[model samples]
Target: MEEDTDFRIRFSSLCFITDHVGFHGTIKSSPSDFVVIEIDEQGQLVNKASDEPIYKVNKMLPEPNNLAKKTKLDRQNLSFEERSNQELSTLAGCSDGDQIHAPGSEKEDTIKDGTSEGEEGNIDVLGSLLDEKTDELLSQFACDVKERWDSKTELIGPSPEFSLGRILDKNQRTILHSAIRQKFPFLVTIGKNSEIVVKPNLEYKELCHLVSEEEAFEFFKYLDAKKENSKFTFKPDVNKDHRKAIHHFINKKFGNLVETKSFPEPNYSADNPSVVITVRFREKAHKHRKRSLLECQERKVIYTAFTLRKENLEMFEAVGFLAIKLGVIPSDFSYAGLKDKKAITYQTMVVRKVTPERLKNIEKEIEKKRMNVFNIRSVDDSLRLGQLKGNHFDIVIRNLKNQINDSANLRERILEAVENVKNKGFVNYYGPQRFGMGRKVHTDQIGLALLKSEMVKAVKLFLTPEDLDDPVNRAKKYFLQTEDAKGTLSLMPEFKVRERALLESLHRFGMTEEGCIQAWFSFPHSMRIFYVHAYSSKIWNEAVSYRLVTYGSEVVEGDLVCLDEDIDDEHLPSSKVHLVTEEEESANTYAIRQVVLPVLGYNIQYPKNKVGKWYQEVLNRDGLQTCRFKIPTLKLNIPGCYRKILKHPCNLSYQLIEDHDIDVMKEGSYIDEATLSLLISFDLDASCYATVCLREIMKHDF
Candidate 1:
């Protein structure tokens, strides 16, 4: 065959490992011509065949009780003192003397009547400040908080704040604080400048630790110095035992951010020192720290896992259609990886919060859409990308007579190619799908623009016309000429989702630099990352080609090799590899097939040889530095990984079929009666592109 000069080959690599003559043929002539079966991490084939029953809700795991709703109902039925004692018991994990008193309770009435042992001289001096109207308003506020607490329904406006007129005497202020705490323990009272203010308590208690009032005050002062928000406060005075109980309550209810500490009153002459406790932020507290204990308790099997078989449908398109039918967003669905759009593929899929019955009911609609789902079951965890072991391919290459002389020649060529692959393997270069097919502007170009922090250029490259006559192309051309996003959007088809989204965002946000960047970001995270990953793949392909040309099939001194021979998955990150040392290479510990090349990223180590220097040359040619991998503005951090230089397909096999033996060929079809076809079947590790393998076998541009 003449030297291939395709742009994709130049962009990636044109190197082929095997020297055997490759026969020409066409693959994916029909949807049935290509087949893919996903293999799960357990080494089990994820195919359409399943013995599991049709999804039913009864077959799912039982759900836990709704504790929040039950608690809300119980709180509504309890009296003020009963509720306080109950909450204290449940939250503090204690009872008895820990109970808080309500107003008019025996303890409070005794203090009010000047009949208590220690408070005989104390009287209700602040009685004039507490009018019946004030008491009613405070009670109403408490009721509102109670009703909305469990459900987290937003309270209208801000929390209600009650202001008490200045009381000159400390004893009178203390009396008022005690009265409020006894009546509404959920409310917090703050005393400043002889004035008292009361509001509903909304404190956090994560990582609680005791600190003195002075320490708490100093921490707030430090925050003021740094101009940070002081999200902490001191609580009203309480007895020593009550302070300890309050600490437990704060820890259990608020989760450790807020802490309680009791200290002696300054310059007190009494035999027993008065105790004052304060709640304040920890020294370096995070506002939204994850609590593993709470997460474990809340985790449940709310996701449904099933196998989906799709024909001639893109993964995203299939997922989007299912999401619409299931009344859920596309984000609710998760899969191991994307499959070929033109092939019949069977892969595992997961959907969150959808019942098995709901999934089963959509079977008819799914079948109408040329898709099948089976083996539905409830799983605690959702399927994640790169979770599969590999994929099994059953591909048919037809029309081999156009290149081969006869059936014998085709069979001999295919057998030689398969055998060569089984032994020497083929270069693991990225396929055309990574850069997109038949597009004027490749995805890698946009990725390069993004890495350069040229958002406008990236956006323009993305919107560049792929064809001169297609409706989507026309719309893109119109926008490029006039920059009228609204007008262009009207001409764009709804099926062109990413294009429509970019136009919609631009129409709303205008066509400024920030707007263009925002429009670029409007694409889904996977779509955005795919472009950058494509660029990385391109560089990786060229590097692998260079390594092969410079060092042939030799295990070089500075090459990186996989440390674990048992690691069947090639999709593992760079952490699995290490540089081959002189000692290891001398001992022949690692083979050339075990060598790995770096994907361009910030978090990877390049080869320690001249091949590493070649990477820098490639990056410089593309106007990129390693620092560009860490784009903080776009939040695009590419942690570069490693991929093996070559891959040997597992269970490789092939057969030559004549036109008469082909079931799909019709009697009066235009195809030649003596046409030869090759049936190829093989298994590849995760992240290995099957099309690249086919390229090695056929030496044809797809």
Candidate 2:
């Protein structure tokens, strides 16, 4: 393959690890072709279901209410007859013993005018029909009904049923039925021969059979018991919708205290399977069992950690989708590092104040977006950037372009290249992703302008468009030509978040230098840091290239190297790096791979050699000095650190195959007999670019 001049000058990837003959192949033909899995600090691989002992919890708990206390007090104070009259009048939607009257309509007032002569005669007859024993019995029944309603304990049993025994007179029975209907709207009355039977209505019966909020807490307590028999099983006979409602109710009310599992009962049909819900205390809940329910709620878990596996989606896009579905902002989530947008990547993500169940609930939704989440568990803290040991890659390169006809010869060449990378490593240049692609101006240009305090230039560079055809570019053009923020925003696409945000701010704050600066600063901290970080990365890449070209991968005097004790597997802080002395270089204490380069910052130390001098020269060319990194107005400071100049792919291996090997060919398609594919797998340290390693093996730019 020929060299790419743009790649060399732009990205500063000037050299390769080996001059071995290589083959050409296409990458990312499909999302699955490039797989990346994160390795955590504990050296454990993060994959689907790889993490153990998942700690599950409900999304939220039922909020506490004082209804029970208020009901109890009211019941104690009011007599049965008076409470019944009040309740009946309430059910009838009228004042006690008064007919519902239309406002502003003239009618005979029962209370103000006193009872009419005809009403008095009917009242007299009804009073004569009633007896003291019957009235006493009815009042006792009302008391029982009130007690049962207040307790709310008979959730899984039969409905509250009572029999009005053997009424001999039909007028008395008819009057009794009317009274029962008025007093207890929740109950239904039936005439069984000479007897009257009263039971709760079907709707009320269904509600009673389902779990209540108070009963959920009781079930939680029962499961939380330390005894051997701590468990609760709910076997309700209901249709599919009712069963689903029961499940949702239990999950919402129980919270994190209990775990519920449902199974289809034996001899049940698929259309409407009888669900048996088994509830037990989660293993972690036992520690908080002694605490009160309020205390437990107050001490609910803080963070939920899970594996997020996404295909062909950028980190921000994936997080944004999740935030919308999970009812949270994107900032609520944190991951160790961003993965490739065109790969099937798996990494650990931690979310604040989220339950494992909430994360699990979105699995179907995320899966529809070609992503998935699993191995959900509660954690005490969030994952920070650079928290992982490394990343594992499984890459397949297809449609190889090579002159070799023999498969054996191609395999031998691929093995040689793989061995070269494993032994000598490759130049550690930041990938193209660090620098925004296909833009009219590079991100580093904006960063340099900011460092030099050229606010207007930086704003112009940010708003300028690469082309006028696209919607976002047209918006940018409109804004630049007319300074019409609203009109520009009208032309802008919603997905161009940063562009739209700047336009929105300009619309409100006016299109002035001060307004632009304020709008720029209003961006999220991560986004604000991104441009400057890209500038630092560009400087580091150039420095690494210069170091390799001049010294040829040898440890030189005045080069900075991290002490063994202070060297971190994940990151190298500036404080740990030490300048190589003449004696240290003479003794050859540090290898070429151990040398580090600074990513220009105010607090970092420069090399004591010519390479260090080159760093200042590069910054000077951009009208930037290291001290300018400290922006007091923005409350921004870059305390950058050292990075290794070389990285070797660990456990590297490769295989060569043809299209027919995987049995993915179409019946009528033609096969390229001359072209073969390469499959490689390896692990890279955190912050290391796998594409750079591949560049060494293939001698091709990504």
Candidate 3:
């Protein structure tokens, strides 16, 4: 039980088996007994086999070549006793039955007496042996990832069942959990209070190792602290459950509005619905533009709304590409908010000083890229940031697995959930989409870098390709990793023309830190600002979640609550952050109907209460200050804004489609063994997310 000084075992300890594809078979002996091979620059083993590298971390391995092999050969020529003491070293995982023989040695590859190489005459027998469970445990550890070619040959084939083996970071335990859910979907119910099946006979050492504890007592203590019990056959979800209470409160508060209404039979699943979104403006009376070819357009600012379906293009990127085709800079076009790149988005955008004819040409170019399924109509005024009322969402959630119960009960449960949302609004937490989607670099990291004035790091993070499968972009990132700016620029593809421009700036301005900051300006101002705003959104969401957990559903005396519905923006309430006076507190008029939270900024005056204190703690945890939001050097400081701590969709409605055609679904598509699906449609004020509402229903299931 003493601390194992085995380097290989220590390396394995740093990895998780459920996260990767290691040696698939069971192994009982220490990894030190196996011949470890070094990997070459090409990510291949330096051996006669010339196999691909498997381990992700083995920095201690010698450089890939025949030098280590020659050294081993030289040692082997010594007496049998000398050869037995010096075993060959190579980098590979070995199961119990697997064999690792020296390239030229005539001896059999077996572990006798716990020693790797045995004496020529007789090997001593050691009582230390690996059990079947321990062997299985050794195989699951994610000590290494194989190269693409090797994975196809040595492990699971390409496109392996659920993309389960790929582990991105050590903090990520969810991938393994996700794989378990995918395999046992029926046993898992996702949401706050989600549950999963637990195997009762798991080994004590396995559990201890998984929990990163050395002692069985400590491991059981950790499990007990988490309230895990062996008698409990299923793991229950422990998240907050306020839906029923909220529904009850809404019935009492808004009695008549809680009436049941019949809904039309939906044609799509709420998950994989064909979305039809239209951006609504703050100004209802805003006039549409007419053709004015006779005179130069007086309105230099042009606002346009366009609908795009499954275009797989970012709103700004598409518009910016169109602008380039029209011989204009990307910055010429501006939008209030970015829309989903993979959905049918009808969004509004602004372009400065463009004729209606020119706008049509730009639209035509965009249409060509979007498979000609789009509509771009120019309006009179430019769309200002935060100028939209809200977006109207027509979303379909697909593959409704609700047929286990009677149809009536399923329908009732869905209707009840929808009704609760319509009346009691759920927590207005920022959806995960607020953060970058599928990007290697997180939005918060870039924002923190900028706040800390690490301009070069921020620039590299933004430009570097995250997904290594993308060979072209991967090559571009490789240059950045090697600090070869010129090479990166030369290899940068046309799709990354913007990144190439930034790289060119780096090459021209010199590779100094200041040069990198100047080059960062090459990216669109909107995109750069979005990174900073992402941090703000994260802070706001965290604060709201903290407030909900701390104060529960009721408002305390010092809480910042919403005043009235007269405020157009439900999220950004017109009511100020007010401290509840004794009179208002006693009257219960200022009770927590809705809370307002701050997005960190220089101008944002955080509430002088517990909520404000949480905000400060969040900032302090990251070594950031509110005052740092004003980055004068970069001229990119953002004044803070307030966001609602809770939001309810206006005119909430939904239709559950029973036995809907599984084939009709194209977006958010999922395989539905169940014939039924759901179609949910709702409207929310600008800056609110429909997905947040859906999260209230689906929870972690989404």
Q: Which candidate ranks first by lDDT, i.e. highest?
A: 1
TM-score of 3: 0.53
TM-score quality measure for candidate 1: 0.63
Candidate lDDT scores, in order, read 0.66, 0.64, 0.45
lDDT agreement of model 1 with the native: 0.66
Q: How many clashing residue pairs, candidate 1?
A: 10
**For candidate 3, which ten residues in a row score worst on lDDT?**
15-24
RMSD in angstroms, candidate 1? Answer: 17.7
TM-score of each: 0.63, 0.61, 0.53
Tell me the tens digit of each residue's lDDT in model 1 across 1-702: 111122134533368888877777788998899999999877778885766523333335433333212222122122111123333232211122222222222232112322221212222322444777766676677677656754667668866667776777766665666555444444556555667676654431111234443443333232212222334444444465556555544543422233445666675446646666555433332234667854544444467889999999877778767865776545567788878888999999888757677789899988988999988877666777788988999999887743444345545676777788788888888777777766677777777778888888788878888657989889988988998998999999876656776786676557888777656655545566778888888778878888888988888789999876567433555678888888887888888878888888877888999899998887877777545587655556787777888888999877666657564433444544357687889999888888899888766667
Per-residue lDDT tens digits for candidate 3, residues 1-702, read: 111122011111111101111111111122221111222223332222312222121112112222213222121121111111112221011011111211212132222212222221111111112235532332232222213222443344432221222333322222223232222211111111121112211122223322222333332222212221211111111211222222222222211211111122244355434322111111112244664743223323344433333245656567646655644455656655566655555444555444434556555555667623233445445444664556666665544444243344444455566676677676676655666644556666677778778887777666667656665677556766786777776677666556765775575455678777656665656666777887777667667766776767666667765565446332443345566665666776754555566777776567666887887776777777545686654558687767766677766666555444424444444444355455566666667766666656543222
* Candidate ordering by lDDT (highest first): 1, 2, 3
Give the residue spans of candidate 3 off by over 4 A: 1-310, 362-364, 371-381, 402-409, 568-575, 658-673
Using alpha carbons, what is the TM-score of model 2? 0.61
For model 2, residues 1-702, the per-residue Cα lDDT tens digits are: 112122224643476646777666688899899999999878778894755623344445432232113222122122111122222222111222222211111122112111222324434543455466754565566567656666864635764556767777765655554444434434445555657666644333334567653454334224222234357776555465566566544433332334466667786786666777776643442452478877786566467888889998877777767765765545567888878888999999988656777678779878988888888877767777788888999999987765355344555566677788788888777777666654567777777666666666776778887755888787787777888887988998865656765676565456777666655643545566677777788788888888888877678898998776436534576557889988988888889878888887777888899998998887776666545587654446887888888778888877665666654434445446465677889998888888788888877665
After superposition, the stretches of candidate 1 with alpha carbons farther than 4 Å from their true spots are 1-13, 51-301, 402-408, 568-576, 582-589, 626-628, 663-674
Give the per-residue Cα lDDT of candidate 1 at 526: 58
- Runs in model 2 with CA error above 4 Å? 1-8, 50-301, 403-409, 663-673
